[model samples]
Target: MNILELRKKAVQLRKRTWELIYNHKNGHTGSDLSCTDILVALYYNVLNQTPETVGTLEADTYIQSKGHAVEIWYEVLADKGYIDRDDLEKGYSTFNSPYIGHPTTDVKGMEFHTGSLGHGLGLGVGVALAAKMNSLKKHTYVLMGDGEQAEGSIWEAAMAASNYNLDNLTAIIDHNDLQITGTTDSVMRSNPISNKYEAFGWNVIEVDGNDLAALIHVLTSENNTGKPRLIVANTVKGKGITVAENRADWHHKVPSQEEFEEGIRELDAQMEALNHE
Candidate 1:
């Protein structure tokens, strides 16, 4: 898809996720919105894996470390035909639903069961290293949260990734600056994040996480160059909705009826603007 089409698709996904979360009465709203464009760019443009190629050695791997934001991931998977729309929209968050608040292997296209912070990067390192040892020319991607950077395990994984020269691994951080309780700076201060990764022997690049064109260019154009890469995707929490933007409470707060209606209106306007463009 072109930049405009990807932008439009982002709005659609945002709208769909908002509806699902509101109806189901649960979700990490801010976390989900903050990472929507990142997921869209990966699933719709960068990823080589499909529903058919999932779990194969020849395909790309995507693990969402910030699993609380799985609502957006679920919507993206459905859009890509990896999961049935009916099952996701209707069965999500219900009794015994595989569609819980986090990523689970039972869901098709999910490479790992993730939710525990700081683990995704380590898992990604292992996958990328295995692929290297197997001599497979495939890539692995891990999407993590800024708050998750506080976990000491992330640094441990960073050191290992560098030691093994897992250049095929690309880790993206949703640098939205907020977690469930409040601002990450107030919590653990993961900024200078790029510098940390660079010192750990990983190549680091920072970009506006919400911009599809920028994301596509960086993700596709960058050469691996014999080191793992980290993209600090600086993003706004509760992106695309005025009321929810940057509010930490929205990290898991279900929207009120009024907030839901307003959110739909904003997303619809975004789509309409894209049509004119």
Candidate 2:
């Protein structure tokens, strides 16, 4: 898909995210909105797996470290045909439902069951290492929240990725600048993120997280340095919605009926603007 198309889809994803949360009366709305563009870009434009072939060893892997945003992931997976839409709409976060609050391997397209913040990078590193050892051509992509970077295990995984020279692995940090508590800067600043990753011996790239062209370019870029790559994606907390944008309270708050309508309107405006552009 073209960049413009991906942008439109991202707007749609943002709308769907709000709808899902509003209907279910639950979700990590702000965080989900923050990363929707990246998710859309990856699933629609980058990743090389299908609903039918997601289990194959050669398929590209995507792990969500910030697993609270699994609602968006489920939506994307369903939209991508990795799972049925009926399952996505009906089976969400219920007993015996493959769709849960966090990702699980039980889900057909989920590469890992991730909810714990710091463990995803470690898992991605391990997957990348195993693929390297087997001389497999697959790449592992891991998405993390900026707040989760505070964990010690993340650093440990970073160190290991560098040590192993896992160039086939890419880690994208959703630097929305807000955690559940407060602003990431005020709570625990993770600034100079790119330099820190570079210092840790990984190739670092920073970009607007909501820009589909930039994300696609970075994802497909050559990394001959033989180190893991980290993309620090600067993003707004509640990206497509006016009220939720940069608001910490929306971190996991479900929108009211009025708020949900307003959020969709904002997304529609965004989509229209992008279409004209």
Cα RMSDs, all models = 0.8, 1.2
Per-residue lDDT of 82-152 in model 2, one digit per residue for the tens? 78888778777667887778889988888788998899999999999999999999989999999998999
For model 1, give the 10-residue run with minimal summed lDDT: 221-230
- Model 1 clash pairs are none
- The lDDT of model 2 is 0.89
Give residue 70's error in model 2 in angstroms. 0.7
If scored against the real structure, what TM-score would every candidate get? 0.99, 0.96
- Note the Cα lDDT for every prediction shown: 0.93, 0.89
lDDT of 2 at 6: 87
- Quote the positional error of residue 111 for candidate 2 in Å: 1.6
Error at 127, model 2, angstroms: 0.5
Stretches > 4 Å off in candidate 1: none
The lDDT, on a scale of 0 to 1, for candidate 1 is: 0.93
